[model samples]
Target: MSKMQPKIISTLKAYSKDQFFKDLTAGLIVAIIALPLSIALAISSGVTPEKGLYTAIIAGFFVSLLGGSRVQIGGPTGAFMVIVYGIVAEFGVAGLTIATIMAGIIMVLMGFLKLGAVIKYIPHPITTGFTSGIALVIFSSQIKDFLGLKIGEVPAAFIEKWAVYLKGIGTFDPMTLAVGGLALGIILLWPKVNRKIPGALIALIVTSALVKILNLDIATIGSKFGEISSALPKLTVPEFDLVYIQMLLPAAFTIAILGSIESLLSAVVSDGMIGGKHRSNMELVGQGVANIMSGLFGGIPATGAIARTVANVKNGGRTPVAGIVHSIALLLILVVFMPLAKMIPLTALAAILIVVAYNMSEWREFKSLLKSPKSDVLVLLITFFLTVLVDLVVAIEVGMVLAAFLFMKRMSEATQVNIEDFDASEEKDGVPVEVHRFDSVDLIKVYEINGPFFFGAADKFISALGELGEKTDILVIRMRHVPIMDATALHGFKRMIEICQRQKTKLIISGIQDQPYKVLEKAGLIDVIGEDHFFTSAVEAVDYANKSVKAHKSGIDSRVL
Candidate 1:
């Protein structure tokens, strides 16, 4: 049993023949489904349709074979459309390829360092916010093709894109609208007819056949981008230079982060669906390999496509073999049926992307989050707006910073520091007690602190200690409720003890837990105070204070005589 136990390399073994048949069928189904969507995503990203196919065939295969998740399907997805479009606009195809390859290497290193778990800490609001924002961008991009508007170039900026679409409103073609409507109709209704054959394929075939039969003057793939090649993709290296690498690093990091988050999230979602677990680090490495290979073949960045992966699992895909087969099926279609893809109308492809946008928006979650804690809602809205109006890299960076600040705010609000008058309160009952007092002044100082003594809260704790007067002889700090501490807090605490030592006052620590006690010892707090000065309770601490006062009085009398 131990020998057969699952490990990273062991899980790579191929499935049995019968299992392979199931996987093949499921993979073929997903591949057919991936085809139209990939083409749509590529066009939406301002790239050729074939690049999407190359991504599906090359990146999609490698990710499944090497990824942590058993059944995640990797390909061009709606999530990457915004970032890829931005990169292409700013740096061109060669630049995009180099950035993707670099991002892939970063992902592989992240997996090696076991940074998979850290990715989960990204706030949920930020994810939902950016996802919905991207959906809006994609939905907007489809307007030109969906309406068959005579717009030459769409602006890349979110606001500018809409402004251009408005200007071109008069150029709307009714025939294009009819085709988009028909395609949408088939997509929405075809599921009721058959699940094995995808709705997208049906929509594309019907739309193409109708357009051809009617001799419609609509824009097709061939009209816009010419015929796609039937041959397999050849290996190509992106033009690489130090300047180019430096320029593309930020974009590459953004791609890496987005891919890591999306892929890991998809794997987790798949795990829930199939009652299986995924090795997250392994999955990161697989995603990295996919991107690197995709770049080598002149393909765009790829990640685990949630929709296709869910479709694979729903259709009896139980192993990574299913994902591999999906890639092979796409390769076969690219080889034999590339010419047929030319017949697909641009309007039909636009309609498919509209559906993709709708799924990506997740507006329901956005609305629900409005009623959540204000901090999270702020993060969500900030991330959403930034992603739409500015750039994804900026959105992620600002969103993370804002989320951290909000987290600290919540923690600070929860923390409390108080000066307890132990003499007047709960100890009035008939319980064993130790009397401690100052000889000159009848005062006992008891400090109560509640919360983590980490760096953020350290200053606040130290400031509270400043309220003590010079006449005070005994200072007892109670840390019974503090669960953790950091070097900054310990340093601040040591300073407060030194202040007491100079004023002829004694410092006593009460209620030290094992963890904090070890921490204090390691920081030399035990040696500073002497071990006998520490006590288990406030009563013991006060008892030691009283004894010290008596000893001080005797020394004062001896000096006077």
Candidate 2:
């Protein structure tokens, strides 16, 4: 129950006036950065721009107050844009809301279960793969806006999307192109001129100003979606339907997964920056709650935004107060200046997303991955193409499976078997004698098998054991190097024991410890061979074998006529 709730009730202190000033500056900057992005992302996601502000206000505030990270800023992110757009298109806002709520509940449950540590288990390569793929998808989705191309219906598949894009190359909106290009230029170049102000906000302001003053025949948000609302969102519930729920489940799952990944990644990044550890499960729960609230209030899906989190850190924002302040700033702007938002151009928002897609691609990492081993490269490429062409869910499932299979293969290959002449004969007639001219009466042969005894190497072990000659009095199976045993090897061990019993020879186990010993004990190998026959070392087994052989010889001598 404690795990389900926030660990600390009160907020951390900023410690200095300078820190407070920095927090205020940083909060304002991040809010400025978030404003255009929230609206642009909302537009891209097939929702109203005001809903985006609503999300940044309500969801962003709650996430910070209850979140694990000290500086994480939660809101609508590009990661959810594709999935959210699909959900809204198919199931409408009501269905999307319900799905988001369902996902939120799942996240709460995940937090209570304390699955924070489990985030580490998600492979780095897999995350990079899907992230890069989503980047490509975002980039592709924006081609229509960037080039102002007109296509009747864009295909969802990657190959088809490109085909449609290529077909519409002739019909480009020149004014739209100019606006997008200029916006991209400002966003890229603004940081060099001023470090404090966000580039995206600058681009939005400049581009919107130009479009309005010049009276360019370009598509503006107001022209397309009408005037922006200036009031806070009213709480509402989605009309529940089994079919809509079923239809939106995939989108919901994508949001949930992407949210988990992004939020955890953001938390990790902030942890590194602030020298503090974050509760991953708690962060996930916060994101879930944020998203649920955002949906109920007619907003888009929200998660921890990496850029905003970094901004918060850089600005000396040491506590959740900065995050709360950021929400307040957005709320103030939404309520006071929503009328002015109508003047923003759609091409400007599209340009923002175009920049977003470029950043998200992580092309440098993609190039580095090209040099990785074949297994990793394959998984990466497969996930990338699947995300761009097929669906995020499909890409994730296939990538995970491939990664797991490759991991198991590597583990299996570590186990090995070796064969050697344990029992030898004298050079009788130049033949390495059929039976060993033993220096000791023990006549115990030792064969050492190393590595895990999984199915991969079980066959080799069985074949090696099968080669034992009939003259052998006893075989000492040395497994000091073996670390693990699986059912397949256990079955092989049973067969080996039976073969020894049938040949009227004793089978002794030596150097068994840890997992091998436990498995052997559970499999009844010790019971069948008699616990006394199992030795801690090969020398002990040999000594036992010698004693048994001497006793047998004495018994035989007694029976002689």
Candidate 3:
């Protein structure tokens, strides 16, 4: 089957009634689990609660209908909280919609270009750093609502936000804090009673009812954002301006990259749980379509929700049908029960988000990574601090560049150039053995390159060759272990050839691997140096060099006679 084929198409060919029942059950359960989560995540992302349901309903439907994973549950997640909040704060909801649509387009292009596999190469330390940083930022953002601080507008900057929170400490409402604590306690303890009914939902119901019954002097969703709309989201086309596009392009790219990483990671995790494979490229395409539809429907950005996906798998969701059902179930809730969402206390939502932040923190991973190599630790620290203190875009950009340079440094260190002499003694079976030395061994110099010949190691190769004395009659380069060579290394070889020609020294290359040989052949280096001088092994090259030296001496003798 093609990699672009969605998993649903294949599964439905053999779909059974029994499996359909299982899918339905799992889907309804996952929908229940996703209810409070979707709303809480939307609020945390600086959007109205209804947008979260819109994302779950629209994006979730498309993702399941077109996705490559059997059990992927697409919806708004905590991962986007920081970036989405920033986008909404800077450019408003309209700007966020445009950016999300742009990101979706980028993701589609990436899938078509077959860059799915390339995304896996993003370093773990960078992911861990940014995730933990985002967690911290999210936790800080929720502090206002959690403590019921009477702040009109919270600053987006991390430090400034904390300063504002500190200044409003005196305005903290005890009633709101009590409601938040009750919700948190329910979420943390509800699993022991009944795991199927999500703790978040239970907390949402209990806290909303308590707050409404008591008429607590606290801010509820209704009081702040007004009535929750039960009607289906209408399609919205954001006004596109060149200035806004240019200003928001970076933000769009950030969303695309982050969404890709999170969705693919969730797919991989689900694949392991179900013993199935997911088409990564197809998954990207599905997520792209989902996000585009989400943005069009006035929804926040969406991706595969890891917690929800796991819940699906655990509940016997073995096919994409379950995912589709999940979206349908959410839609029903949106149309029927959305009006009650207004009574939910803001502090309860804040508590749910705080739990989300804790789960996504990856604090243990961060602590473990600090004990890694110094270079890795440096990248982690820089990425972490930059993400917290600066923009996520800057953190990811700088982290990638720094990781690339550090990787090159490590590879260069691995690329070894060892000088070999045929006159050196050898050992056989732990006993000293006499090695056959060529007659012109003193005149022949050999250097063996034992790793990838790339730009990082090109200068090292040239410097190693420079160490050869001027009296050399022939230079043999052994490249048996060099699996690959880049253009810079090829240029270095050209320079070496020039030096050999200047000194009237014969150049012989031996044991070139297939890839490096093809590179040299394509660059016309083989023709420039003559194919006859190339050998399959260093021994052959050394033998040829010795014979050439003897022939030269004989020609001189004959001329003298």
Which is the leading candidate under TM-score?
3
Strongest candidate by lDDT: 3
Ranking by TM-score: 3, 1, 2
Sequence-dependent TM-score of model 2:
0.88
Q: Each prediction's Cα RMSD?
A: 3.8, 5.8, 2.8
What lDDT score belongs to each candidate, Candidate 1 first? 0.86, 0.79, 0.90
Instruction: Give the CA lDDT, 0 to 100, for residue 108 in model 2.
Output: 64
Candidate 1 residue-wise lDDT, 395-437, digit = tens:
9899999999999888877777777655522232557555444
Between prediction 2 and prediction 3, the one with superior TM-score is 3
Q: What tens digits encode model 3's per-residue C-alpha lDDT throughout 1-561?
A: 229888899999999999999999999999999999999889889899999999998999988998889999999998888899999999999999999999999998888888888889999999998999999998998999999998889889999989988888999999889999999999999999999999999999999999888888889899989988999999988889999999999999999999999999999999999899999899889999999999999998999999999999999999999999999999999999999999999999999999999999999999999999999999999999999999899999999999999999999999998887765443435576564566876777888898999999998999987877777878888887899999999999999988888887788898788999899899998988788888876556666877777877777431121
Q: TM-score per candidate, in order?
A: 0.92, 0.88, 0.96
What C-alpha lDDT does candidate 2 achieve relative to the native structure? 0.79
As for model 3, its CA RMSD to the true structure in angstroms is 2.8
lDDT of 2 by residue, 1-561 (tens): 124444234334325677667778788888988999999888888888898898898888878888877788999888887777777787777776887787776666667677766766776678888888887787777788777776766776678889888988898899889998998899899999998887888988998899889998777788878877898889998787887777777667777777878888898899899898777777777888888888788777888999889988998877777888899999999989888888887777887888888888888999998899888899889988887777788888888899988877876677667653345322334555343322343354666788888887798888887677777677778787888888999999988888888887778787787898888888777788778777875556555666666766667531121
- The TM-score that candidate 1 achieves is 0.92
Model 3: ten consecutive residues of lowest lDDT: 552-561
Candidate 1: residue 75 Cα off by (Å)? 1.0
Report clashes for each candidate as comma-separated counts.
1, 1, 0
